[model samples]
Target: MGKPISGSAADNSDVSFGLTLMAIAVLIAPLIDIFSKLAIATIPSGQITAIRFTLQVLFILPVVALRGALFDLTWKKTALHALRGVLLVATMLSFITTLKVMEVADAIAIFFVEPIILTILGSIFLKETIGWRRYTACGVGFFGAMLVVQPSMQEVGLIALLPIVSAFTLAVFLLVTRLVAQSEDPWSMQFHAGIWGALFSAALLYFGEGTGSDVFDPVVPDALSLVYVLGVGVAATISGVLGVYAYRAAPASVLAPLQYLEIVSATLFGWLVFNDLPDALKWLGISIIITSGLYIIWREHRLNKTAGTAPVSPAI
Candidate 1:
């Protein structure tokens, strides 16, 4: 209520605060996979996906209502949101399926290919220019993903491809989200997407019932399973909101590199929760992937700084 902070002072404060939030978000992000992996033991991936989205909608709708943003959707915007949500559902379903058979760290390491894919897709669809160095980094990142995939393929068979599939789908989802991200608040955007995601996953579950598919068969959660399901929803909601706020407060270039911290959390949780640890070769791959990803983020930061372009929030 006194004087408001302004100028470079305010900017530095905001960046510092945003980074703190993003670090927390990165720490919390691994829990979603952990809970999903736990839930998948008892619940089918489809049902878990539906429950996750349903809980997100329930958690977000109240915020949207309070903000009076629920009635502002145009048809084009609604369709875009729906498309993004569908893509997200595909990504989650694939990821969770992989979680069923793979160690969480391995699955997450493979999925880390997303930033590379997002960069390529940005060049193709958004017409963003990428320098040769950044392109090389992307190539190296893919190689690192392959390193993780090779061992996982031997261990988990064809299921090793699921996280890669999820990465691609997630890249596309980010591309579409970029197109429609305008003046809408992040909470509102997430709320609408959650609604569509819940609907889409619900339909999939309905049609997929009795197929005897491990990924598609729906199961009624018992008391314990319900806790895991709720954990998934709660973790997702918190991390997602934190991500949005973090991006809003700082440049995506600054925040993007920090996201690699999730791999550390994934590794720790994998070891602690499931007693699963990546082998030396897999760890080497993870290091390479993290290096390439960090290089890409560094390059982006340099380019943005040199070009003096305003920072855009990345769709995580």
Candidate 2:
């Protein structure tokens, strides 16, 4: 063999920086959840979701201009971005609505089914292969989600289904992100996604006018509630952008498991901010969901290792 490669040092550095970005992004991500949960107390979840994407667009517009990529999008990319925005809007609307009734930790726990959905979808749509063990884990993961949702169903009726919907939509959103990330830069992704999200949500708001639907009803929040709304937007912008760059910098298998840290931070914030804690049953369910998800991630890593493939990480 030739001399061992020294240039691998640069690759290691990139992965290190990527992992750091992922950690910071994951830890701070729950701030979005917290802020949305707080904001929706006075604002409709739909309006709150709209404001997030709107502010993300406003916040990132300057950066995109500074990078000279503000006009880089092709029409096809524009359509893809719009689809991503719609799926993401659906994800946020569903999850935040769940927060209107469910505890942050619990809602997030149920939302943890996303990884399983993503894996199964990847197998079906991307033609990625899945073994029986991973399939079994996915089944167990869904069962665990039901364990958490069963109680919420009793307490809040069908409202608990929203998180499952959130999980499915988010999985699809991730699939799109994976596809788009191959060609589009992460900042452009954010900018276009925000534009589409803002447009779609505004359309919903307009159509919701006079419908008397609680979820769609717009509200002029008080000063404090307005602060919460702003917090939601800012926190989302930060997490969303960081997450995009983090994925851009690293392989998916290495970065995927870091997301579990979000649940940990979310639990802490939920307890500290809202004094909400998962009961034993919810905790058991959260554990199972996490374990199953991690196993799936590990299997992905092994397959990638065997094939010497580096999978792309998805954006926010």
Candidate 3:
């Protein structure tokens, strides 16, 4: 949400400060889920997703206007963005469903499998080369995912599969993001993402109504629900912006590891808010996923170092 820092010492200080701020921003995500769950007590999931992105688009309108990035969209990039928008909406809806049904920690741990999915897709679609070390990293990351998901457990619900699917969808979104980033300005890409995501979700809200389905509870929207919706919008926006800034400020190697913090934070939040403590198997799964994620990062670092090239794109 703040301006990205530049070359001055003071700016470097600001960058350091922003790193901490980004971690706090990451925490806001789980808090958003906490709020959304509370809101879902009175609002439908479709309506909530729609409202979340509606407010996000509204929030971005002024910036898109001020920067004059509104007209930057062209037909060439339109299709790609539209595809990404569809995937993004799917991830949002599915992740929210998982958030409603599972502990935030478990959901996020499963979602951390994104890097593995992304790397695999990279080699297949993007033709990015993969090495043994990176393959090993992928293995470790999936192991960690298993630790969190613990599919074999008696209490584990089949619905938990949604988060893994959501993670794969998100990985596709990231792959598209990387492809688009080379040709499109970040603001323009973000603008398209927000606008299209909102439109897609809005259509779902419309159809839900058409089917005589309940959309909103018609209860008086209290301050808490309003706060949660507003927070979801604002927090999501902050994460997007700060994520861009973090990449600019430091190498992906430095910032990529910081993402693991989200898992720890979510685990803590899950325990504190939902009393969803992880058993030994879940703990093992979480450990495996985290290790795999880090291993991928490390493998990327090693490859880049040996090849004498810069770091690879950091996947979310």
Measured against the true structure, the TM-scores of the candidates, in listed sequence, are 0.94, 0.92, 0.85
**Candidate 3, poorest ten consecutive residues by summed lDDT:** 307-316
Off by over 4 Å in 2: 1-6, 305-316
Using alpha carbons, what is the TM-score of model 3?
Answer: 0.85
Backbone clashes under 3 angstroms, per model: 0, 0, 7
What is each predicted model's overall lDDT from 0 to 1?
0.83, 0.81, 0.69
Ranked by TM-score from best down, the candidates are: 1, 2, 3
Ranking of models by lDDT: 1, 2, 3
Tens digit of lDDT per residue, candidate 3, span 1-316?
Answer: 9886556877667668656655655655566666566666666666777777787677777787898888787787888888877887787777676666677777777877877887888889978889887887787777677666665334557767877788788778877877788877777777777778778888887666646444422234677878877777776776666666666665556566667777777778778877887778887887887777777777777777311111111111
lDDT of 1 by residue, 1-316 (tens): 7887779889998899888988888888888999999999989998988899888888888788999988888889989999988998998999998898999989988888888888888888888999899899999999999999998999879999999898898889877876777656667778888888889999998888999878777877899999998998888878888887877898777677778788888889999999999999999999999898888878888777311111111122
Candidate 3 stretches with Cα past 4 Å from truth are 1-18, 151-153, 210-223, 305-316
Hey, what RMSD does candidate 2 come out at?
3.7
Winner of 2 and 3 under TM-score? 2
